[model samples]
Target chain A: MNNYSTFGTALHRLAILCYVLFALFPLFWLLKVSVTPNDLLYSEGVRMWPSRMSFEHFRFVLAHSAFPVFFRNSMIVAGATAVIVTLLASLSGYALSRFTFRGKYWLVALMLLTQMFPLVMLVAPIFKMLSPLGLTNSLTGLVVVYTAFNIPFATFLMQSFFDGIPKELEEAAKIDGATQFMAFRQIVLPLTLPGIAATLGFVFTAAWSELLFALMLISGNSAATFPVGLLTFVSKFSVDFGQMMAAGVLALIPACLFFLFIQRYLVQGLTAGAVKG
Target chain B: MVFDATAGFPESRRRSLVDRITRHAEPYLYTAPALILIVTIMLAPLVLGLSYAFRDVHLLNPFSGGYVGLDHFRTLYDDDNFYRALRNTLWWTGASVLLQFVFGLILALLLDRPFAGRAIAQALVFLPWAVPTFLTGLNWAWLFNPVIGPLPHWLYALGLMNEPANILSNPQLAMWGPIIANVWWGIPFFAITLLAALQAIPRDLYEAAAIDGAGAFRRFTSITLPFLAPTIAITVLLRTVWISNFADLIIVMTSGGPADRTQIVASYIFTQAFRALDFGYASAIALVLLVLLLAYSMLIVMLRQVLMDRA
Candidate 1:
């Protein structure tokens, strides 16, 4: 509707192209160096593409390293955290959305306060607390920590989604002799699938990329998550750039898969609501 | 369609005593599991961490759990490194947030306009946020390397530098290394949120304004800016708090190094607790940080309230 001049339009597209390049260039270089053979790495001298590319680095990382175990551990922790956080967020979010209760405003304020606190404050105490219970250095401990860390934001996110659905649908279900919980399960949840998917993706990627706590809590090879593993790999190999970048690419795959889901719902105004539906 | 008629029925349902009690308890029931977990996992640890600031609780020393009232705080008062970290924290948070917001807003405005291949472009541009922070730090660090990476070479050729050198090593410029990487990683976050808020804007408002002879700039100022104000305010406020607390990029890229020029309070706290095993000192710094952050949040909130009341 605001289309005015071709010159203006060209400038806008050019600006967009710049952003895309700026966003992708670092990642592109990651892939470039990861594939470039060691001899060509220094010899080629900053060529955009390698003179000859090979999978030697990728092969080495996958075959001769603890990365695979770390990868699995990270997946399990992130996946479990996402599922648990989403489930709990859905319930709490539903309460915030649909009910008028005592202390509701305080509940909201408390959640916001949680967000404001420096998470670093909790690291030492959390380690100390978990150590006595034999929960330190375990995947379960990581999952529990991650779930609590993510809940406040996820609750807010899911609440926004729940607010978007019209109340009429659930009321109709209730009028037909269905309970509130039943209506919520059968009628409300199906419509909020997109919202749920987005929350899952957000929380999963957060737990996956979390470094500070993971590094503090876990030690040794068996239970190490990918971020911890990546750091250790760097020090152990002593600047093997190709193998490091190769491991970095491998670490990015799950996030990329979930990114597809996030973008789809995110552009749809985060839910199938009437205003932007 | 059948729901519409019942939606107007406001009398609520008849209920027995048990049902009334259940109805009163319903929201609590729904929220209990989450609330319990959060209290135990996050809230309790936070309280414990604060108390640790007053005691000597070294992790390795079995005899270290002793009351040491005000000792840590007294040391913090005199610590030169702590003061330096505070100064650096301000710089890092200010520069990172400002740059990210400006670039992110521009990106959002660009993406908001309809164009061919917009979906693909949006996805591609947002891809940086998906790259984990650790990798982002490592990747940017590598890019600034003088040998394998092209950036130092490009800067030298452009006469920005006399010789190809890594800015990550220069104490004066070391902080920029992480700030630049942070902007790249975090812009997509701001863009995604702003774009969502932008899309929620009523399209007809713009159309009506145009028909009334308002120019593009005038319409944006009178309409778009007003609509975007709340999102912009909350995002910037929360992001400021978050970015200040964020230490991963600094730790990964520079390790707060090159003569400790890049050391932020958050990274300093992490290093103390994680590397030094000095829980008492780490918790002490963390408490100060927590107080400062809380005060900052309170100030903004009150300021916003006053502004809203005026408006």
Candidate 2:
């Protein structure tokens, strides 16, 4: 037998098992609900697995509905916002992390102050501001709004990443006759890939799931995102659990795929190789 | 294009111009995009919100409005729903943050041990963090369904609940349903941050404690807990600030329903601006939330100062 306390170790293992199961059970249920035949939803009553499985809802959502358009719209908005914000954040973050400039402290304080206000307060004014410019119902408008909202946090995220990198490498590149921008692009940019990936994934997910602004700005289904589309399952009278959960399950795929694609970089602490201890 | 003019200009003026450009060039180049976007998109709306808050603003009354000078705030203060929303928001921000920190601390400590399959276990624990907030809210809403939910069904099977009760339909339980969901979603962040800090602790500390004959509980108190304190405090602050602004969860789960029972500041503001179309009053309530967040941030700064002094 092992010298370690069997009872304590077993208890620990049991606790971990319980927590993992608890955390994962919802996703399992989502998959389960999505597969359950619509007729058996109420009659079968909380069964872990459905007696019969069907892909009818997914078929209906994909082919016979506007969900595909909504899906495409979400992808466009998320992709554009992520790319734009990351590009903006990387430069600003590098400056914040490396440079000592005039009014640097005040600029940082101003950014922090912007974050303090509730976003809801800004909605009406934002709408008022956007409507006049013919931007209320456009994908570009959504991207603009998301880029604005995500930039501060992304900048901070990128700043921390930049801080993790040593300044000596850039100095070395400068001494070798490269300009600042050249050094940043050639050396620092490659090292900051992990941070950029994380920021892109973060901003993408945020824009994808955002409902409030999308709801407020877009009136028609043309510009409506998946979150707003999910609301269509809710009529005034009765909530359609089958279609809603089905849509919910479908909406998770892009996010899942995005994470799966970027998960490698996300898990790797890339700053480790950028600087020597 | 202006080479001849540059020669005609004073030498000192020319030198200063070059100096200015060189001195300011890099930071200006780097910060230009962010500053332009932030000023136009963020700052303009902020100023516009403040001005809209003071006017008798409505959706139909786009910009042509009369000044109301705290009238909206007064109406807001008198409204019972506002107070309820404030109370519920306070409970949400405070309770969720504290409970999440506690559970995360416990989980992190357990996982910090040398064990097989620890990485897989950590990933599973972090699954909730990756799920979208709306989806998480929907999942919890289903889990608390009265007739056909696993949780209530299991509770009934275990002889815990009287009936397969709709927890979200209940005023007392509905508020907590979202809070519980938030805590579950938020725990992974705290766990990850704390685990990183825990891994940085020197093994010598534990060995020294064992040499002094300190048992597991004693070691936890004397070594682990103290070392983890600063990280715990900072992570808690971050989670609190994030959770206080949480609208997606509340909006999807309840829509502040069952008699405005679960309304928090953020969701309340959403409804006021969107549902009621009362922009002025909504902006006032949002300003209230802004003030609250500012105060909490000040507290975080103070906490950081204290932690630095202790270090």
Candidate 3:
């Protein structure tokens, strides 16, 4: 029995190690190629690590290429979308948590319907709609679209967080002459800081990673998001694997940071939601 | 005191009426901004997109946008690529979901066991879900490139290939590239959800079962599977719909390449609209996909209802 248990433990650990390596290997490769010197890239074929590394790719991508602009544009759009979506989602989520009102059911159903359909269907029509208003090729346009796209999911996320808080806190404030909105803003909002952060991070990552809409809406390098810019660069300069990987590495940074920040809350938040759901 | 209270009651009654009106409008007030945005941005475009399927709308053609009922759908019916794409969608969604669910379940079960450094292990294993989809596509594509990537060489050494050639260019093997990338990216979603569900299964059940001389496998089969069934059902259903629509990996890696072998319906629609500039045809394809997804969802919901009723 002791030997059997020891064997089981070893198997479990080995399984875990395999999963970790599989998860990290591609990312490891991305980093490795990005830092490898151009002179050694072809010569060091299939190496786990280059004999020597340099910052040349990163420097070229930063100074000579249009990646910095794309990065800045992505940061602005994602930041704005995160802020806007979180704010709207918080209010609506609070309402969903606290109130039983007309249209609440329909509102949720509509949001779920949005999730079920292909957003690609909206690509052409949205372009037509925005083109007339001169919203195409603009970061503001991307932010608006991303905010709308993210609101439904973020609202549900925020609602789950709000549901975890006791209703009595807001009810107590309400009885003490606070309006419902006032109670929400002053009492409830501050309590759900973790949820707010998670939603912000979630929306930020999503907006940062969005590809198709960014590709369709933005025409030029000046307004392109990271994904679109990288893709365009991939096609335009197919030879510069090192430079492209460096850009790819840069794109991974903010998302990984946000993921690390919110992953704990992500599981916790979902568990609460799932149990309640 | 009675006279003073009577006088204040009328004033308070009027104030209370105003408060009642405000209370009734409060939720709507809170939801209005989000609702308005959804309507204008998502809902309205969806309706317009449906209409676009019936009209002849071309991006570069000034003479287009005329009503041409059933024209695009008629064309879609005869388009060989559309049928091929439909077939590919099934294979792609099935293979990706199956692998992700299986691996995710295993990982979740593994992580459920408490051990030293479990927290860090959990974080590391779940890290892939954070990589952006486009980057996931690019990273995997690069990994399959024969010149820079080691995969071809490794496969050759293992006698799985004739030589160190890029699989992305091989029609028979190209779909695997995107599917592999997708599986790697998607496993965390299932693991996170399943792990949560696993954790929710009462620990006392396992203890009680063990006390009754039930083995580990027996306890899992009797306790864990049943507890996880509902979560598993819903997550799998939702993920099926989501993954069918996910074309980023395919689009980035192969662009439905070699011979359009990887052209799933979602990517096919994208190609039509983006590359061919045929919005009408794209919307028509999208409409078909939408109906199919709705039917799948409806079927799942009805099945769940039937299962619940039986229970």
Candidate 4:
């Protein structure tokens, strides 16, 4: 029976391996297309490795194309949104998780209500509202829209994080003659590092890749993000798969680096060994 | 502040009053940033959009438009395009969320047990979630390119279709194509959430089942499932709300195109305001969409509560 179970475990391991490969194939394909020399792209006939690989597309995208500007714009928008949304969400999440006020339930109900609407529905009205203020063509406008869209979800995220922390810690701090602000800043915020990191990463990635609002709000190259930059690969006639794939690969670095930086916080449990078993 | 507010009261009154006020006030202060932003950015726009629904305004007459009081809604109700957008939006949300959750759960379950190379496997499975949506959409676009795409080329080679075809140009299939991409993009979220929940479940229950001579299927149903119910339900609720509001995927992949066949409420509303310059009517349509969204969310919350109670 033990031997049979060992066999079963091995089979399970194999199954997991297959599943993982399947899940990652698209990413593998992304890397493949990004590196395959354009001359050999079609000639290679679905070969996993091209006879020759080139960084020429990346070189052109970085040096010759407007991709660098798009990259800079994306970083600014995403970074600002992440910081702004995380700050707001941490505060709001704390409120939702801890408080009982006159309109607490209704406030939550309203926030949830805001999330239900397809944001596309608000696009025109938002543009109309922003256009007159000369905010439509600016990165600030994109950041504002992304922050608005991300905060509700990020708030929920933060609230759950705060919820995971013990209220006893804050209570103990208050008894020690700490103000609410002091207790939160000194005690609670440190414990919520994991949650803060998660929120930051979530909002950062969200703002980074946001295409719809960027496409609609930003009219020119000055404010355009990488997603809109990818669209430039498609003119009226044919799509440039090689350069587009290369650009897609390049656009991935910031998101990858952001995750790498945050992965520690993403997995860590700041509340670990805090409370008694 | 609470102590100050209660300092005027008698000794007995002061303690209770201050405690009460502080208990109530703390949450507000903690959540003030989120509240202020949500109110100003999200709620304000919602209110502003609703007001636009009542006006007879065009793009040129943003502030000077006359209040028409539901005329735009009436036009929306009478419009065939609205119905099509409504139906497509429903289909997009329903199909995308259901498939994503189902596939995600399956993947999560398959990967739940500790095994060799589990960490690497988990990372690879979660890769799609880390990659940006724009890149995924762009990559999928390349994969769907008829002449150049591997899918059509392989299909043609296998005699599945007559020629390399532009799937996005087909009115009927464009929405589904984007839905597929969206589902692929979202599956990792479901997988991660469910996996977290699954990991939290105690191993003792499975041990109890093993002692009872329960097979894998029996253990899953009897021990694993009932425990994971709340997490699964919440995951479904979150995914449904999110998928329903998905405008980005459609924007990148289809743009509600090939003769408005893929026009979900979000994309269609965008066209009205940004492309068509119909601000008043667009706002009216947005209002309707918001109401429907609220109704759906309420249903999910209520359903979740009912299920939690039962479980």
> Model 4 scores what on Cα lDDT?
0.77
Best by TM-score: 3
Score candidate 4 by TM-score against the native: 0.87
Every prediction: chain A TM-score: 0.93, 0.90, 0.97, 0.88
Can you write out model 4's per-residue Cα lDDT over B134-227, one digit (the tens) per residue? 7777677677776456766776789976877767887867777788788777877787777766766778988988898999899989877887
Where does candidate 4 stray beyond 4 Å? A1-11, A95-101, A167-177, A233-238, A260-277, B1-30, B60-64, B298-311
The lDDT per prediction is: 0.91, 0.82, 0.93, 0.77
lDDT of 3 by residue, B1-311 (tens): 97677566787786896799999999999999999999999999999999999999999998999999998889988999999999999999999999999999999999999999988898988999999999999999999999888899999999999999999999998999999999999999999999999988889999999999999999989999999998898889889999999999999999998799999999998998899889998999999999998898889889888988998
Tens-digit lDDT string for candidate 4 (A214-261) = 877888788888888777555422445667678888888878787666
Q: Which segments of model 3 are wrong by more than 4 Å?
A: A275-277, B1-9
Interface RMSD of 4: 3.6
Ranking by DockQ: 3, 1, 2, 4
Docking class of 1: medium
The clash count for each model shown is: 0, 0, 0, 2
TM-score of each: 0.93, 0.92, 0.97, 0.87
- Model 1 Cα shift for residue B57 (angstroms): 1.3
B120-198: candidate 2 lDDT, tens digit per residue: 7877887787777878888888888854468888877899878888778888778888998898888877777777777
| Candidate 4 local Cα displacement, residue B205, angstroms | 1.7
lDDT of 1 at B64: 97
C-alpha positional error of residue B170 in candidate 1 after TM-score superposition, expressed in Å: 1.1
